[model samples]
Target chain A: MTLSLPNLGLGIGWRAQLAHAILNRPDIGFVEILAEDYFLSETIPPPLQALHDRGVHIIPHGVGLNLGGAEPIDPARLAALGELAQRMQAPFVSEHIAFVRAAGLETGHLLPIPRTHAMLDILVKNIRQAEAALPVPLVLENIAILFDWPNAEMDEAAFLNAICERTDALLLLDLENIYANARNLGGDPVALLDRLPLERVAYVHVAGGYEADGVFHDTHAHPLHEEVVALVEALYARMAVPGVMLERDDRFPDDAELGTELDAIAAAIARGNIERHERGFAHPVLSDAS
Target chain B: MMSASREAISDTQADLVRALVHGTPVPAGFDEQRVQAVARSLVNKRRQALARIWPSLVKRVGDSFIAKFTEYGQTHPLPTSANALADGRAFLAWLAVKEPPTDDLRIEALAYDLRWRETPLGLCRRGGFGIKIARLAQSEKWLLGLRTPWRGDRWWGMPANV
Candidate 1:
C-alpha cells in the first residue's frame, strides 16, 4: 500500500486557544486537530472551518484509539474518525500506538505497551482494524515511556518498526519523545533515529517540556527547549522527513514566543534540507524514491 | 510460560493502566520508580485536562485538586464514551462521594446536563430535558461569568430533543 504523505513542512497542533494565532499566521504549512475534539460534534466549529477555507492542510490526530489494547477497536470511534476525515478532507488521521483503555477502563492518557511479540501482534491487528474502517490513512505515533518493560523482546525502534512493517502504517516520530526517552530510558536519540526506517515517518513532532529535580517530562506547556530543537536538527539531518510540527498544549506563550519556536524549527528544517541537497539526498516526492 | 495471545497482551496493558491510574502494583519487568513517576505525571495531566473542563472546581479545590483527583482517578477511570466536559462531570460525581458536594460541582454537572449525558456507547446530547431548566442553568453559569447565557434567538431556537 502506497501513501502520498504530503511534505507538510512546519505545522502546529490546532488548539482553540491558539486559533487566532494560527489563522492569522502565514508561515504554518499545516495544522493538526485532535480528532476526539471534533469527532463528537455535529458540525464544524467556525474557527476550524475558517482554517480549512484558508487552504492549509488540517490533519485529525487522535489519542483515544487505544490501538494496542487486547480488546476490539471501538466502531463508533472509528466511525467518528471517518466522519471527521471526510469533513476535514485530511490526507491522513494519526493516533498513538499506545493504548488508552483496557478492561472497560479509560486511562485518559497514552500508556506504553510492552514491546514483546505478543503485544506487537495485538497492536498490528488493532491498527489494521482502524485502517480498514477509517476514511484515510491512519498513521501511528511512537509514545514516550518513562520505563521499559522488563520482559520486552526488542528495542523501542525495532518494535515500532515491526508494527509499521506488519501493518503498513506510517510513522509520526515525535522527537521530544525520543529525547525524553533517551534521557529517562537510557539510549542515544540520534542512534535510535538512525536505526528506524525513515521512509515510514509521515511527519515529526517537536515540543517543549519541563525538567524537575534533574528529570525531564514532555509537558508540552513550556517553551520549546534548545536541546529539543537540536534533536529536531539531528533528525532532519538524518531523514529529511516530509514534514514536522510543533505541539503546545498549555502555558502557551505569546505570539512572539510561538513565532520564535516555529522559526527555530523551520531554520532547523532548512539546515537539514541544505545538508540533504549537498549530500545529494533524493528529492522527496511522495515516497522514499532515491 | 504465559501465553502470548491477544488476551494476554490486553491483560498486561490493563495491568499497566491499573498501576498508572488505579494504584495497582507495577507489573514485573518495568522500572518501578520510573513507572511510578509516569503514573504520577498522568494524574497531574488529568488535573490539567479537567482544569480546562472545570476551572471553577479546580480553583475551589485550590491545592487539593491534584490530591483529590489522584484519589478520585484510581477507580473512576475516564468516561470511555464522553469528552472532557462529561469526564469533568463524572469527576465531580466521584468527588460528591469523596468530599462534600459543593454548589460549584453540582452547578457544573447541571451545566453538563444542559449539554449531554452518558450513553452505553458514548455521550449523546440531551433530549426531553426542559428548555426552561437549561435556560436557568445557563443563567446560573452567567453568575460565574463562565459563559454567555444562551440568548437572543440561539438558545430558544435549539430543538428540545437535539
Candidate 2:
C-alpha cells in the first residue's frame, strides 16, 4: 500500500491549558487532540473549532484503544474515534501500538506487548479491525517501555516494520521514546532509525524527559533535551519527514518557552534538510525549504 | 518457532498488568527491577492524575497525600471506566474511612456528589433532581446542595451561628 501524506509541518499537541498559547501561534500547521476529550461533548470546543476554522489540520489521537491487547478491540471506542475523526475532518487518526488495559483491569498507562510473532499476529488483527472501523487511515505509534518482555521474536525495528507492513498502518515515530529506549534498553537510536521504514512515518513526535536513578523517563513534563533535538536532526536528515510536533503533558512552561522549543525543532529540521541536500538526496516536499 | 496462542498471550498480559498495579510477583524472566520501576511510575502517574482531579483533597492532605494515595493505589487498581473523577471519588471515599473528613474536604466531596453520581461503569452526571446536606465538622452550620436537571447546581452554606 502506498501513502501520499501531506507535509504537516511543525505543530504542537492541542491541550486545554495550552489552547490559548497554541492558537496565538500563527506558524502551527496542525494540532493533535486526545480523542476521548470530546467523546461526550456535542460539538468541538470553541478553541479547537477556531483552530479548525483557521485551516489547521486537527488529528484525533486515541490513548485508550488497547490495540495490542489480547482481547478484541472495543467496538464502542472504535466508533467514537471514527465519529470524532469525521467531526474534526481529520486526514488520519493515530493510536499507540501498546495496550492500556487487559482482562478486567485498566492500567491507566500504556504497557508494552511481547514482540513475539504470535503477539505480532494479534497486533495485526487488531490494527486491521481498527482500520476497517475508522473513517480515515490509521497511524500507530511506538510507546516508551520500561522493560522488554521475557522473550521476543524480533527487535523493535523489525517488529514495528512487520506491523506496518501487514496492516499498511502509517507510523508516528516519537523521537523521545527512541532516545529513552536507547538510553535504558541499550541500542543505537540512529541504527534503529536506519532499519525502520522511514517512508511509512506519517509524522514524528518530539517531547522532553529526564533521567532518574540512571534510567531515562519520557515524562513529557520537562524541557526538550539537546540529545532529543539531535535525534530530530538525524531523522529529518534521512527522510522527508511529513510532520513533526511537540507533546508536553505536564509542567507546562510559558508561551515564550514553548515557542523557543519549536524554533529549536525547526532549526534542527532545517539542518537535517541541509545535510540531506548536501548528500545529493532530493525530496519533493522539502526541496523548496532546503 | 514457538507460537503463543491468543489465550496464552491473554493470560500473560493479564499477569503482567496484575504485577504492575496489584504488586504481584514479577513475571518470570522479566527484569524484576525494571518491572518495579514501571510499577512505581504507574503509581506516581495515577497519583498525579488524582491530584489534578482532586486539588482540594491534595491540598488538605498536604505532604501526607502522596503516601496515602500510594497506599490506596496498591490494592485498588484504577477504575475500569477510566474516569478521573471516579478515581478521585473512590480515593476520597477510602480517605474518609481512615480519617474524619474535615469541613473543607466534606464540602468538596459533597460538591462533586451534587453534580455526579457514582455508577458501576463510572461517574455519570446526575440528570434528575437531588438534594444533599452536610454538617460542618466544627460548628452547627449545615450546607445544602441542590442539583437540578437544567439549572446546574445551587449551594447554600448555613450561617456560623445557625
Candidate 3:
C-alpha cells in the first residue's frame, strides 16, 4: 500500500556532515530528512531543501507524535507536521508505535505500551487522526522496546497487523529494530515478519546500533553490522519494498564513511535479488531544487 | 521452607520505581528492590522527558544533543529537581562537566529518546536559561561544550572571541 514513490534505492538520513559530500556526489538513491527540521516557516534547514531540490526523494521520519499513547493525538502538532509534509512533497512520513507521554505524565521517551485490544483501539484512532490531518501516508515503525507488559494481550506481530489493518496506513519496517527486539525480547524475527502483513510495508529502515550487556541498542551511530544487513536482505527477498534509508544519529562519520555504508546497503539489495535498478528518475537532481 | 521461585519485590523497590517515574518521595532505606525500582523509574523518566521535549530541542540544537540529554537524564535519574524541566537542565549541566557516560541502561534510554522525540529548540532554550547552562563555553585552547550557565552561578571561562 505504499503511495507512489520516486524509487529511492538506498537513502541516507540527512546530516550536516554529509550534506556537501552528498550534493557533490549525488549518486545515492535518495535522502530521508527528519520532517520537523524543515517545517519552520521563518527558517529552514538549507541542506534538506537542497536535497529535495537535487531530486532526492525526501522521506520524513518523525520522533515525538507518541502514536501509541493513551492521550489524544495533538491536532496542533499534526497540523504543523502536515504543513511541513505538503511543503516538502514527502512521499511518506514515519513514527514509532510507542507512547512518549502517559496519562497526565510526559516522559519524553518512546515508552512501551501494553499490547492489549484496548491499546490497539487507541493506536488505530491515533493513526487515523494523523492520517486525516496529513496528505501523506503515515507509516508506523516497530520500536525496539526494552520492556514488555506482564499482561500483553497479543504478540508483537498480531498487534501491529491489527493497527495497520484498521488505519489503512503503511508499515516502515525497521529491520534493525526487529533484529534488536528479537535478541532482547523473546521473539523470532523471521516468524514475526511472517505473521505481519508485509504487503503494507512502504519502505525499510536500516541503521547501526551500539551493543551493551549483549543487547543492541538502536543508537544509529555505529556501522551497520553484517547480521542486520543479512536480515535486511532476507526481508527484501520476501517483499518488494521500494526504498531503504540508513540512519545515523551520533558520532557522525566523514562523507566517505557514509558513502561506503550506502554502497554496502545497495550491494546487499543486489545480492538479495532485487532487480530493476535500470529505470532512473526522470527529473535531474539539480533541476528539482527550489 | 525455601523462598518462592520468584520472591516478591520489596515495597522499597516499588517505591523507588515510583519515585523515579512519578517524581514521588523516596524514603531512604535502599535495598535491591529500591535499586531495581530506581533504575526502571530513571529509565522511564528520562524517556518521558526526551519524548516530550526532543522534537523542539533537536530543531534548536543538533542530533548530537539528543544523545547528550538522554545520557544526562538516565545517569542522573535521582535528579535534584521535582520535575522533567529541572531534571533535564541539571542532567545537561552534569553531562557537560562530568566524564563520559558508561552505563548501558543509561545509554539505552538515551538512544530511545533520540529515536522518539523531535524536541523543540524553544523549550531547550528556556530550559537552558532556567538552569543558566550554556551550550558552549570557551577555554584557552579550545571551545568546550561545557554545561555551565552564562550569567548564573559558577560562571567560568572567557567570553567568546577573547
Candidate 4:
C-alpha cells in the first residue's frame, strides 16, 4: 500500500526546553509535540503556534492511547488526541504499539505486550478504532521493551507488519528502540530492520541510551549513540525514509551539543544516499556494457 | 499460535502490571530477573518524572527520596490524573502520615492543599475560594495560603521573629 507520506526531512521532537533552539534553527523541517501536553489547554502554546505559522509540520505524538491493551481504546483519550491533531493541523499523529495503563492503573511507562496472534488481533482492533476516530492518518511506533513476554508467537517485526497491514496504518520506526531491544534482548539490529515494513514508515526516532548491569536502557536523556546513528545510515541505505527526528526527553544539553547530534544524523543520511546511488549505478541492468 | 482470549489477555496484563508496580509475585512463565529489572526501571522513570515536577520535594527529601518514593509507589499505583503535580500531591499526602514534615515540606504541601482538592477520582484544581494555614515544623512559623478562582494563589509567611 502506498502511504503517500510527505518527506518531512530532518526534525526534532518538540520539547518546551528546546523551543528557543528549535525556533532559531531554520533548517528544521518539522516538530512533534506531545499530544497530552496541549490537551487541556484551550489555545496552542505560542511557540508551537509560531512553528505552525512558520510551516514546520507539527505531529501530535500520543503516549497514553494503550493500543496494545485488550480493553477497547478509551474514547475520551482518543478524542483528545484527535482534537489536538486538528488544532495543530498535524499531518499525521503518532502513538506507540504498547500499552501504558491497564486494570485502572497507570504504569507511567509503556509496557510491552505479548506478540501472540490473539494480542495482534487486539492491537489491530484498537488501531482501527483509533484510525476511525483520528482526523488524520495514524502512525504506530514500536516501543523499547526491557523484556519480551513468555509466549510462543511472532517476533517484533512480524507483529508490527501484521498490525500495519491489517489497519493500513503507517509506522513510526524508532531506531534507538530497535538498538536497545537488540542490545538488551538477544537479536541483530540490522537484521531486524531488514524484516520491518520500512515502506510503511512515516518517520524515524533516534535517541541515546546507556548500558547498566548488562542492560541497555533507552533513556532519551543522554547523547545519541554512534551505533544508533549507524542504524540511521543503515535504514536510509535500505529505503527512502520520510522523516527522522531526535528525541531527547531529559538532561537536555545546550544548543551546540544538540546541533552536533543533528549534524551526525544528517551526515549519516548523506553517506547512505551516496552508497544508494553507487549501488544503483553498479546495478546489472544499468551497466555500461548494456 | 498460542491463542489467548481477550479476557485472558486482560488478566495476564493485570498480573504483569501488578508484578511491576504493586510488588506482587512475578507471573508464571516470565523470567523473574528481567521482570525485576523492568520494575526497577519503571520506578526510576517515575522518580525522574516526579523529580522534574517536584524538584524541591525530592531535593528536600535528599538522599532518602528514592527510598521514600519507591515505598510510596509500590502501594499507590500512579494516580489516574497522570499529572505529575497530582502524583506529587498524593505523595506529599502519604508522606504526611508516615513522617513529620519539614517546614519546607509543610509549606509545599500547603500550597498544593490550598490550590487543589483531592477527590476519589483524582486531584481537582480549586476554582472558587480556599484558605489553608500551616505551621512550619522547624521555624514554628505560621504560613497562610489563599486561592481565588480569578486572582490566583497568594501566600503570606509570619515574620521571622515570630
Interface RMSD of each: 2.2, 2.0, 9.8, 2.6
All candidates' lDDT scores? Answer: 0.76, 0.86, 0.61, 0.84
Worst 10 residues of 3 chain A by lDDT: A281-290
Question: What is the CA-based DockQ of model 2?
Answer: 0.61
Report fnat, model 1: 0.68
* Model 1 lDDT per residue over A145-236, tens place: 76766677899989977887898788899999988888876889888987888888889898998778667888888888887788777776
Candidate 4 residues lying further than 4 Å off, grouped into runs, are A281-290, B1-4, B114-130, B135-142, B158-162
Cα lDDT of model 3 by residue, A1-290, tens digit: 43454466777777766677678666666777765454445345687777777777777677667687655687766876777777777776788887654333444445566677766776787898999888878888888765555566798888888887788788888888888888776678877876877767777888988767655677687998888888776665555467777888666778788778878887777765442222223311211110
Give the CAPRI rating of model 4: medium
Native contacts retained, all candidates in order: 0.68, 0.70, 0.01, 0.62
For model 1, how does the per-residue alpha-carbon lDDT over B55-108 read when each residue is reduced to its tens digit?
887886678777777787666666776366666777788887776665455555
- Residue A242, model 3: lDDT of 74
The TM-score between candidate 1 and the true structure equals 0.87
Name the regions of candidate 2 deviating beyond 4 angstroms: A282-290, B1-4, B117-128, B159-162
lDDT of 2 by residue, A171-201 (tens): 9999999999999998999999989888888
Pick the lDDT winner: 2
Candidate structures ordered by lDDT, highest first: 2, 4, 1, 3
Query: What's the C-alpha lDDT at position B25 in model 3?
Result: 68
Number of the top TM-score candidate = 2
Candidate 4 per-residue lDDT over residues B1-162, each given as its tens digit: 334588888888999988888878988988889888888777677778888767888888789888898888768877886767778888888998998888888888788778766542335566788889876758867788888888889999885454
